[model samples]
Target: MRFIIEVLLSGLAIFLAALILPDSAASVDGFGWAILAGLIIAFVNATIGTVLRFFTFPLNILTLGLISFIITVLMVQLTSYLMGSRFDVANFWWAAVFAIVVAVIQMLLDGIFGAKPRD
Candidate 1:
């Protein structure tokens, strides 16, 4: 199903983040938890992130869209806390870096899967 594929893709993103960021730690043994965390993250980003972005449109514009990284880090921290997973990211900076890596990996996967429409 699409949902299952998305979850797996998210887990792959998390794994890639863990691999790419030295300070970001994730356990392969916690794949189920990672999937659940990813689902929660996707839901929060879809709902809360959308609302926050709308309200912070001015800041987003002023920052040239850089503030999105902060939002992503916060969402990741929230997901980690909610899941009670041992996956540990040291600080906001590390979280941001990890998030960027995850985003890149996700985008690459989406490209490979042709999930995103080509121009």
Candidate 2:
């Protein structure tokens, strides 16, 4: 349930980001592409990203967690690379911006949807 909700939120965020930053973020011809990209991102972040965070713990701590932002950018670029035209990030700077915006929106959505109700 949580996974499905997160993926939907991510897709919404990606679609919105592409609309807002057309020069930086792009989805191929349909909302499906954005949804696919979002699923890919969620999978990568859960698997590879977790290992990366574990290995880069020192760097993340040293940089006061800013390194996690870089990791997010890499994840976004990796999605573009793997999906080719289905998803595209203009460049590293653009990926950074796109990733930042997506991350912020995802966090907010998760906070709302994943929140526990008080007794």
Assess each prediction's global lDDT (C-alpha) against the native. 0.74, 0.81
List, residue by residue over 1-119, the lDDT tens digit for candidate 2. 65566667788888778777875455544578888999898788888888999999999999999888788788888999999987898888889888877778777777877755445
lDDT score, residue 91, model 1? Answer: 62
- For TM-score, the strongest prediction is 2
Which candidate has the top score in lDDT?
A: 2
Name the regions of candidate 1 deviating beyond 4 angstroms. 23-29, 116-119
List the candidate 2 regions with Cα displacement exceeding 4 Å: 107-119
lDDT of 1: 0.74
Against the true structure, candidate 2 reaches a TM-score of 0.82
lDDT of 2 at 25: 55
The 10-residue segment of model 1 with minimum total lDDT is: 21-30
